[model samples]
Target: MSDINRVAVIGCGTIGMSWASLFLAHGLEVQAYDPAPGREAPLRDFIAVATTSIGRPVPADTTALRWCMELEDAVGNVEFVQENGPDAEDAKRTLLAAIDRLTPAHSVIATSTSSQIRSAITADCRHPERHIVAHPFNPPHLVPLVEILGGADWAVERSTALYRRLGRHPIVMRREMRGHIANRLTSALWREALFILQEGGASVADIDDAVRYGPGLRWAIMGPYLTYHLAGGPGGIRHFLDHLLPGHVKRWAELGTPVLDADLEAKIVQGVLEALGDRSIADCMRARDAMLVALASLSSAADDAQDDLRGDA
Candidate 1:
C-alpha cells in the first residue's frame, strides 16, 4: 500500500540482484547501480531466473529495470532505496552517506546488512533518521522474513507497510543488535555445528540431515518459543521451565567452542564436497529453491485453513 513505487537498488551482488527481482516482481520500477563492469548480462539473467522461482506476476519485459553507472543517477529521483553494499564498516558508511545526500528527503534508505547494526552504518550520514536496516534472509526473492530495525518512526512505519505489501513478513526490532535476531540464532547453531564437526561427533551430512528432517521441519511453521511451549503440553511454558530447563542448561554448559583452524576448515570443505558429489553450486541452489517454493505453498494453505477455523470459532 506504499505510495512509493520507484525504488533504487545499490550494488549488484547476490543480495542486490535478489532485491531487484523481488521489487520488480511486486510491480515496482527498479533503478539499479553497481561499479562492476559487464554486470548487465548476469543481472538480467538472475532476475529472469528469480522471477520464475518467486511464483509471482512479474513484468513481461525487463524494461522496468534501469541500469545506472553512477550512484547519484540511480537514486536521484527514487522514492525508496535498498542498499546491498559490502559489510565492511567504512564501505557501508561511505555508501550510505552518499545515498542520504542524493536521495529525496522523504525517501527511506534501507540497508541489506546481515551483521552490522544500522546506527554504526549510518553514523556518518547527515540524515540518520531516514535510514534503517532491512536484512532479508538468503535469496531475498524466495525468503519471506525480513528483519527491520532503526530509522525514525515514520520511516519504520513506511518500510514495514511496503515490505508487507510485497508479501514479506517483516519483524521490526525495538532495539538495534549486532546480528539482528535471526542471524544471531543461526550463528549460534552454526557454531555448534562447527564444534560437532571438529569434535568428530557427527559428519557434515549428518548434521544437515538432523536439522532438515528434524527441528528444521517444525521451525518452518513455528518458532522455538512456540514449539517449546507446546512441548510443555497442558501446563505450557511453566511446565517446560520446571521440568526441562535444567537439561537445557546442562547442554548449554557442555557446548564446545571450536575454532575454525586450517585442519577443521579442510575437513568441512571436503565433507561438503563429498556430500555434493556430482551436484554443482547452481544445481544445489535450484534444488533448494524448488523445495522452498513447495514449502511456502504448504505453509500458505495451512495458514488459510487456520484462518477459516478461527472464523468458525
Candidate 2:
C-alpha cells in the first residue's frame, strides 16, 4: 500500500460510487468513470450522503475527485482499480481485459462482483495474478467488510493493507470460490427462511425478526462457531464437537431447499411490501445506517469494559 494514493473506481454505480466516497473521505485521489453520460452529479450526490451516513467528514474539497468518461483515462496512472460492472461473466472478462491492458502492470485490479468467481473474471486478463475479487456489502460506505479472493500473495497483501488503511475489515480467502464467504452462509439461511415463508410457517417480517433480534444480535458479539462453543459450558468446543455435534446433523438434514417460482415470488413481493409498511427505501436505508453506527459504538464500549475487567483480574 506504499505510495498508493490514487484509486480508479471504474464504474459509477452504487458500489463504485461508495468506494469513491470512502476513498475520498480517507484523502485518496479518486478517478471515477462510467460509460453512461451524466453520472457525475449522481455520484457526487451519493458521496455526500454516504459520507454523512458513516460519520466521516464530507470531502472538504471535491478537487480530489477526477470524473472520467473514458476507461483508459481513469486507470492510466491509478495504483488500484475497483471495477463495478454488471454481473455477467463475459462482460466482466472483457472489461477486466481492457482495464488490464490500460492500467500500469503494478496496479492491482479487483472486481466488486458479489458472486462471480476469479477464474471467470480473470480469464482474459494478461496479468491474472494481480486480478482479484474485492466484494463489499451493499451500502459499502457503512459496511466495514470487504471479501478478497484470488490474487498473488503480493497483490493480496497490498489490497488487504489498503482496506485496513481505510478502516475496513478485509477477509482474504485461502481458496477461490463463487459466492465467497459471507454470501454463502447467508444464502443458506435465506433458502430455509424462504421455504418457511412459502409454507406459511412464518411471516416475512417474523422471519426477519427471528434473525435480526435473535442470531443477528448474538452474531455481532461472536459468530455461530464461538457462540456454540460457549453453549457447551465448562466442556467447551472439544466436548461439544464430541458429544453435542451429532444433534445438529438431523436439523441440517431437515433444512428446506426452496425454489423461487412465480407463486412464491409473488408471495415474497407482497409480504415484503406489507413488512415495509409505510417506510420508503430511503427511510429504511437511513435507519439501517444509523443502527450500524450505533452497533459499532456498542462494540467499542464492550471492548473497553472487557479490558478493565482483565486489569482487575
Candidate 3:
C-alpha cells in the first residue's frame, strides 16, 4: 500500500550505505549510485556489518541491489530517491537539480543533509516541491530518529508514512532551519562541553560519562521536557516553571561558548585519542553499536511495561 517500494540511493558513503542496508532489510529494492571507483565491495562490506549491528538479516534476493554508474540510471524507475551527496551548498544544489530533472514528477527526493536547509539545496531545482530534507542520526540503521523538513503537504505525508513503514521515528518540522531541531540542541550541548574541557572542568572521558551514565540514560526514555515535568514533584510543569525557570536562566547566562582554536583542538584530539586507548576505530564503533542495541532493547521493554501499567489503570 506504500507508495515507496523501490528507492534510489545517490551516494554510497557511511550515511548512504546505512540507508541502503535499512531499505534492503525492509525488503525494498535499492538502486545505488556513487562516483567513487571500486566502491561496491566496501559498500557491500559496510552493509553486511550494519545489518548485523541492527540485527536485521539482509534479504536473500541479491537482485534487490543494483549498482549504477550513471545518476540517470539510478533514479529512472525508483519511487523515492534518497540523496546523500556532499553537504556543500553548491554541490548539493547541482546534484539536486540533476535529480529533479531526471526523476519522475511524483517520485519524492529526500536529501540526507544534516546542516543545509532544504530550500537552499533545492533552490536551483525545477521541482522544489517534491524535494525535502530527511536527515537521519548517525548509523541510520540503528537510530530511529529521522528529522524531516520542507516539502509540500502531500510529499511530507508520503515521506512520514514511508519512514514509519521502515520502523523509523520521523519528525516533521513546521519550517526549515540550518540545523533543524535535534542538531541545534546537540550543537548547543557540544559547545558547552568544549567550554568545559577548555576550562579544565572535566576530561573528555569524564564529560562523556557525565552524559552516558546520567541524562543520556533518561533521554533514551523521555526527553528533557517530560524529565523536568517530573522534576516539579507532584505539582507538575507549572510548578517547575515557577520555581526552576529562573535558575535555568541564570545558568544559561553563565554558559561559555568556547572557540575551537589550535590549542583547544589539540586538547580535544589528545583527549579523544587517550579515551580510545588501544581500540581501533572499528573496534570502538562495534562496541558503541553493541551498547546501542542493548539500550534499544531496554527502552522497548520499558515502553511495553509502561503500556501494561496504563492498561491496568
Candidate 4:
C-alpha cells in the first residue's frame, strides 16, 4: 500500500538509531550506514532497547536490516533516505550531496536536523528539490512530532504520507525557516525559563515542577492558544483577546531578556546536574522515552486552529 518499502538511515547516532528502529518496526528494509567504526553493535543494542520498550520483538537474523560500510551501498537502491548527520551546516551539505548522488532519483531525502534549514543543507545537492527537513522530536521511535519542510510538493506529500504510516504526526512548514516550528516555540519557552532562572524566581527543580504539575497538564492535551480559548468560556479566543489580553501583554513586557553569560551558563549547567543528581543519561532517556510513548498513545491529532471559525477540534 506504501511506496516506501526500503529506507537508508545515513547516521548511527541516537536520532538515526531511533529512525531505523521505527522503520524496521513498520516492516521496511533498512540499510544503515554510519561513518563511525564499531557502531553496529551499539545500534542494534539501542534498537533492542527501543523495541522491547514498545513491546515489539525484533527477529535476531532478519534480512530486513543491513549494516553497510559504504554510503553508496546504503543509498544506491533505497526509496527513502533519513539523514541524521552532524548538525553543522557544512557537514550536512556535504553529506546530503553524497546521498543525493548515490540515492535513486525518485527517492526522498529527509534531514533530521534541528538547527539548519533545508535550503542551507541541500545547497550542494544536485537534486535539492527531493530534499526535506523531517526533524523529529528526540527519540523518533516514541515521540511522533515530525516537522517537515521542502521545496517540492510531491516530495513533501510523499514524506508526509510515509510519516503518517509510521504513526507520526507530520507538520509541513509552508515556508522555510531555521529551527522550523516546534523548536522555535521550544526556544521561546527556553528563553523565558532561563530568564526566570537568571532572576532567581525559582530553583531549577521547582521551575520544572511548576511546569510539570501546572500548565504542562493542560499542555499535554492542548497548547497555550487552545487553553486560552477555553479560558474565555462562552466567547472563546475573541473574548479572551478583548478581556484578558492586556494582562498577558503587561506580563510579556515584564518578561526578562536573559543573556547567557559564563555565570548564567554555569548556573544552568550546575542546576541541571543537581536536578539530575543520581540519574544517569541512560536512565533519563529510557524513562523519558517510556513516558513519551505513553503520552503519544493517549494523544489524538489535536486541532491546529488554522481553519477554526468557531474553532477546529
Q: Which candidate is the best by TM-score?
A: 1
For model 1, which pairs clash? none
Tens-place lDDT digits, model 3, residues 1-313:
3668899999999999999999988889899999888888888888777777778777434788899989999998887999999999999999999999999998899999888877787998888998889999988888889999868988888888999898788999987777999999999999999999999999998999999899998888899999999999999899999999899999999999998799999999999999889999989888889988887788778888999999999
Give candidate 3 regions above 4 Å deviation.
59-61, 311-313
Off by over 4 Å in 2: 59-61, 301-313
Cα lDDT tens digits, model 4, 142-197, are 88889998858989988999999988889988887778888888888889999999
Give the Å error, residue 197, model 2.
Answer: 1.0
**In candidate 2, what are the lDDT values of residues 1-313, reduced to their tens digit?**
5567999998888789889888888888899999988999899888888777767766645688988878999999998999998888888989999999999998999899877878877888889999989999986777788999868888888999999888788999889767888999988888999999988899999998999899998999988889989988899898889888999887898788888799999989999999999999989988988988788778879978999999999
Distance (Å) between predicted and true CA of 133, model 2? 0.9
Better of 2 and 3 by lDDT: 3
For model 1 the local lDDT of residue 216 reads 97
Candidate 1 lDDT: 0.90
lDDT score for residue 234 of model 1: 97
lDDT (C-alpha) at residue 53 in model 2: 71
Q: Quick one: best lDDT, which candidate? A: 1
Residue-pair clashes per candidate, as listed?
0, 0, 0, 0
Q: Model 2's lDDT to the true fold?
A: 0.88
The model with the greater TM-score, 2 or 3, is 3
TM-score of 1: 0.97
> Model 2: how far is 183 from its true place, Å?
0.7
